[model samples]
Target: MGYLFGPVLSRRLGLSMGVDLLKYKTCNLDCVYCELGRTACLTSCRDRFVPRQKVIREIELRRAEPFDHLTFAGSGEPTLSLDLGEIVSRAKELVNSPVAVITNSTLLSSPSVRKEVSAADVVLPSLDAVSEKAFQSINRPASGLLAADMIEGLKEFRKEYSGEIWLEVMLVKGINDEEAEEIARAAESTEPDRIQLNTVVRTPAEPVEPLSEEEMRRMLEIFPGAELIPDWDWCVPDRIRDRLMELLMARPGTLEEISCHLKIDGSDAIKYCKIMENDGLISRRLHGGKLYFHAIDES
Candidate 1:
């Protein structure tokens, strides 16, 4: 499970099994709001960071696992992996689940890079800024990288690829929030299937600010058809939490079992379970090929 990580409950992609193509924190952009701390190996150069055959072998081994998407994400930008296209193609052959690639939209400027990324069934690309100053302040890109070129690259990508494109816009308060309208216009110009809005929800590398939900709602007017995808509120209701804890205390339950017994949606079950797990209220285990959560006996 070195290259392959969770079938984690992603808000947008559902239960996505992640594929890490690059090394830890190796990215072209040292984004101010990155959750993986700072970029350790910062470069725009694409190379074979991991063994292509090894990644494919791992994918072959895990192809039967239940997941919605075999997502190319985690650690750093997936586009930075030179073997991305071959790996993606191989994964498609080995797995029934749709393939996805999440990128920062910097390397899309290169036609070859765009071609490599287009192999995925779905592409989730981010555009946080349209102005160079905003881009530099938020993304802290490698030298010679321009926001305008990124936008143009996205536009070009739209023209070339027929696959589903869910363009994401990360808006940090005061950093790139001011240019929301411009970013939205550029995003619209790309003609993506969907435009998703996100903000700093995790503990970021830098002390950045996230916009309020009300502000995000206001932005919907600016962006027209864009959808806000941040986990804005991390609260689970007292009743649900109590019931879930009681259920887990009695006996361990897989996500499906918890959802069925509680008469809650599967996604809600995952959200509650994750929050409880983080709070040390419950613990996770894998038994008979299914993930289960049981209450921790703190006595």
Candidate 2:
């Protein structure tokens, strides 16, 4: 699993199989709220950090695994990989699942990068700030990266890419949170299929603060139709949780199987699974071309 990890339960993308293309912590931006800590290599240059064939071979091997998306999201910005386009193309050819790329939106300014990333069925790009001050305070981008250029690049990308674009806005409390209106206007200009709003839920690289759930709710008024992605309360009902754990302890089951057995709707089943997975109570595996969840053996 050097190149591939986790058909993990993602908050947004269900059962996402992650593809890491770059070395650990290799990114152009040192974002304050990044869960992976500081950027070890902060260069804007794109190079073949890992052997391309090895990565492709891993994807080829896992082609039969069930996942909602074959995601190209590395420990750092994925577009920084020189082999992104080719690998994305290869994944699309190799897997039945939709291909996705999660980018920091810094490199989207380059036409070459935009063209390469367009190969993905879905692109989740983040825009935290529109103003230079807020951008610098939040993203801490490389020497030459500009907020204006990032915005323009997203607009350009929207024109060329035919697939779904789910624009993400990572709002940090007292940082870029003030610029929500401006960011929302900019996000709307990109014509993304969905605008997803996220705040600091994971332990951040810096000791930043997350907005209250109420604050996030009010943000819906600002960015109409934008989906909130922050972990609020993060509680799965006790009855459902116990039942899921019991079921998984008996035998592994797919989402569909779990939904049918529990007599819960698909959405509720996924929501519960995601919460349990986050709490490390359960884990997922791909078997027989389907994703199955099982309780983690503490022993």
Q: What is candidate 2's lDDT per residue for 1-299, written digit by digit as tens?
A: 58999877776787789999999999999999999999999999998888999999999998887777899996899999999999999999999989999999989989999999999999999999999999999999999999999999999999999999999999999999999999999999989999999999988999999998999999999999999887684678898898989999999988988999989877667888888887899987767777788999797
Residue 136 displacement in candidate 1 (angstroms): 1.4
- lDDT measured at residue 87 in model 2 versus the true structure, 0 to 100: 92
Residue-pair clashes, model 1: 0
The positional error of residue 63 in candidate 1, measured at the CA in angstroms, is 2.7
What's the TM for model 1? 0.88
TM-score of every candidate: 0.88, 0.91
Candidates in order have lDDT scores of 0.90, 0.91
Instruction: Kindly report which residue stretches of model 2 are placed more than 4 angstroms away from their true locations once superposed.
Output: 237-251, 262-267, 277-290, 294-299
lDDT of 1 by residue, 202-258 (tens): 999999999999998899999998888888666689999999989998999988899
Residue 39 lDDT in model 2? 92
Off by over 4 Å in 1: 238-251, 257-265, 295-299
